[model samples]
Target: MMLTKEEERALSGEYGEALSQAMRILVKVGEVLGAERLVPISHAHASGVSYATIGEPGVHWLESLVKGGAKVSVYSTVNPIGFDPYSDIIKVDENFVKGQIRILEAFEKMGFDTSLTCTPYYLREPKPFERLAWGESSAVIYANTVLGAFTNREGGPVAVAAAIAGKIYEAGLQVLENRRTDSRIRLGFRPTDAAEWSAVGYAIGERIGQGIPRLEVPPPPRDHLKYMLAASAASGGLAMMVIEGVTPPKTYLLGEEEKVEIGREDVEHMFGSVEDADLVFHGCPHASLKELVELDNLIKEKVEKEVWVAVAPRLYERANDVIKSLSKKGVKFVRGTCLVVSPIDKMGIRKVATTSAKTYFYLKRRGLDVWLVRLRDVASA
Candidate 1:
């Protein structure tokens, strides 16, 4: 991979051992991916922060970087952990807490904002055409597809390395020519809500694999777009897609290839029948302020089952009054963690009812049964 004079110095250990190692990692990754050069990034978000997902080996890897004096050279944020640090909302074992604490400390030492959320865009919104090295799947898709920013779905360590070096390999979604839409997918029926949009995304992913699709659909709600992106990432490993009106037109080139049509019936088959669930979860990508408010309004009535909703630390702090009111109605607001990474099964939550296909997708991987429904339906059920 080609590098600037400053980048060469970083690789040659002029900056320090940690930075040199980070530079080396980027160089090797660039070479393997056929990147022509390194590009400076404006922001980064590191994943694999949860002990439930990354365990002792991940902790060791991060702490070793910290011991080598690694620190973020750019604005960086962290993903969710296994549980809430300040509350008993996610009830995991003491051992789990201990391990998660070490991971949190390591990130803190590295100068990362411990937001503990998958939606880093909520913390610092990226501008169109801005370069980012984000690791969280949902965030990467949102950056590339929604905000028109440039980033591929980075791995945990690679994102951290980019954070320290403030640079990433110029390849994948960073190049404008690479982000062209290869196919046309038209929605036969409009999605009614976020859950339906999520289901549509799941169906699309299953059908089109990694194809760069341009969707011809109605203007979905903002929250629905979040669910759509997360579900697409979960089911298809999709890094980016083009929405009809949302995505910037100039960012990606359109092509006339195979035309795929998706209808409501197709999405209906993907959803299983809803039954009584042990728990109800929301916020796989972490709830936005608007989502929290909507959820709070929905659950003003009595709750029959245990419900958990996770949000970013900033949202948790800013919406304290609203959160406290929701807590009174039996809605537990989980901070620093979401249902995807948390050990909810250990807490006797084997069956989950959720409004997110992304949540359903991840939970199914853990041998948990999920019932997919709209947010209002979940609230009323």
Candidate 2:
């Protein structure tokens, strides 16, 4: 691969140890992937922020970069942490707090924007064709498919390297040829809610795993689409999905791509089985302001069971009144953390109900019994 004089200098340590190492990481990744050159990125969203998930090794690695005087070179943000920074709806043990604080300090040292949500696209809107290095799988799919931006499903360290260097290798989804839709998915029914959308997404993902699948159905609302793609990625490792009307046509080519049809029965089968739930969770990718408001309305008649709504701090602030009102009615608001990353088992939340298919899949792995339900019907369930 050819490199400009500045890039070569950075890799050779002229830019200081931290940046030099970061440059080396990106360069090596580029070489491995056969990327000829590095592409400038408009943004970078780092994942693995939760202490409960990343633990000591993650903290140590991040601290080393901070001690080396490392900082992001471009607009960058972090994923959700282990707990809410502003509020304490969920309990945290002493050991968890000690480690979580260290991780937070390291992130702050690197100048990561504490928007602290999986959905960085909500914070810094990506222009069509803009390049980004984002870690969260849901965000990666959304950026590529919905916003018409260019990015692969980068890992935590790779995204951090891109942040420090302000660039990433121009390979994978960054190239137009690689973004081609390889298969078509025909939907028999339009998903009426997040649960149905998630079910359909799961079916498509199970049938067509990695490559792009063009949906024949009309585009659902952005909010619904977010949940659907999140579930698909969780269930079947989908990085990019092409919707017939939603995805920008010019970004992907569709020629002789295999076609598959998914019916209502297939979607129902993917919904999984759990009749009753002890607790309800929302916002696997972090709730949007609109979602928070809708949740508030849905829980007007408080039930015996606890309902946890996880959201980004920015969204919490934006929808302050609604969230506060819901809290009064016995709804719990968790900031900067979702059930998937946080210690749900520690909280004694064994039986759970949620609208996110992604959350259902993950919590189940932890041995929690999760019931899949739509947001509107959650109260009745």
Candidate 3:
């Protein structure tokens, strides 16, 4: 792979050891991926932040980078941690809290925003063709498909490196020719709610696997689109899906792809009832402010069952009044964390019902009985 003089100097340790190490990682990755050269990125979002996800080794790695003088060269943010430091709704051990704090401190020391969200696009909307180095699966797909930004499905460490280097390889989704789809998905029925949207996405992912698909459907609402994108990425390892009218023209190309149709019956069975759930959760991607407000409007009085809503700390602060009102109505706001990353099994949350298929996918793998439900049903229950 070819490197500019500045990149060569950084890789040769002319910069601090931390930056040299970061540059080395990127160059190795670029070579392995057949990248010809490195390109500058506008933003970077690193994942694997949750204490439950990474444990002690991950914490030590971040601390090592920080100690090596690693600092972001571009605007960067981090994924959700194990739990919200500000909220007491989720119970965790003292060790867990201590480990989580250490992880957050390391990222902060390295100049990351510590946004604690999988949905960095919500924090800063990327423009069309903007270059980014984002780690989260859902966020990668969303940025590529919906926002028309250029990025690969980067790993946690690589994303952190990209933040330090302000550059990624000119390969994968960063190359426009690689954005073409060879598969197509046609929705036979319209999704009525967020749950249905998620179900559809999950089904599409299962059918297509990692293949990018051209979606034949009307443009979905922004919130619903997020649910679908999150579920698809969770279920299928999808990095991009070109919507019929939603995706920006010239960003993606449709080929003579094999077609698959999904009907209402195909997805309806995915939505399980909420009758026997121990906990009702929402926001696997972290709820947007609009979603939080909609949830507030859905519940008229205090709910009888335990209901938790995960949101980014910034969004939680912005919608403080709405969150407080929802709290009075028995809605617990989990700031900066979601069921997928939080230690829910340790909390004895066995039977989980949520509006996100992505949440259902992860929690089920953790030996919990997870089911999908509509947002209204979650609020009412």
Report every candidate's CA lDDT: 0.85, 0.84, 0.90
Q: Is candidate 1 or candidate 2 better by lDDT?
A: 1
> Please, what is the TM-score per model?
0.96, 0.96, 0.98
**Candidate 3, superposed: residue stretches over 4 Å from native:** none
Worst 10 residues of 1 by lDDT: 269-278
Deviation from native of the Cα of residue 189 in model 1, angstroms: 1.3
**Which tens-of-lDDT digit does each residue in 7-107 have in candidate 2?**
99989888788888898899899899999999899899998888888899989999999987799989999998887777776778888889989988887
| Model 1 clashing residue pairs (backbone) | none
Error of 1 at 379 (Å): 1.8
Which stretches in model 2 have alpha-carbon errors above 4 Å?
270-275
Score residue 270 of candidate 3 by CA lDDT: 68
Report the CA-based lDDT of candidate 3 relative to the real structure: 0.90
Q: In model 1, what is the error at residue 130, expressed in angstroms?
A: 0.4
For candidate 3, lDDT tens digit of each residue in 160-243?
999999999889999989899988888888787898899999998888888789888889988999999999999898999999
C-alpha lDDT (0 to 100) for residue 103 of candidate 3: 95
Candidate 1 deviant stretches above 4 angstroms: 272-275
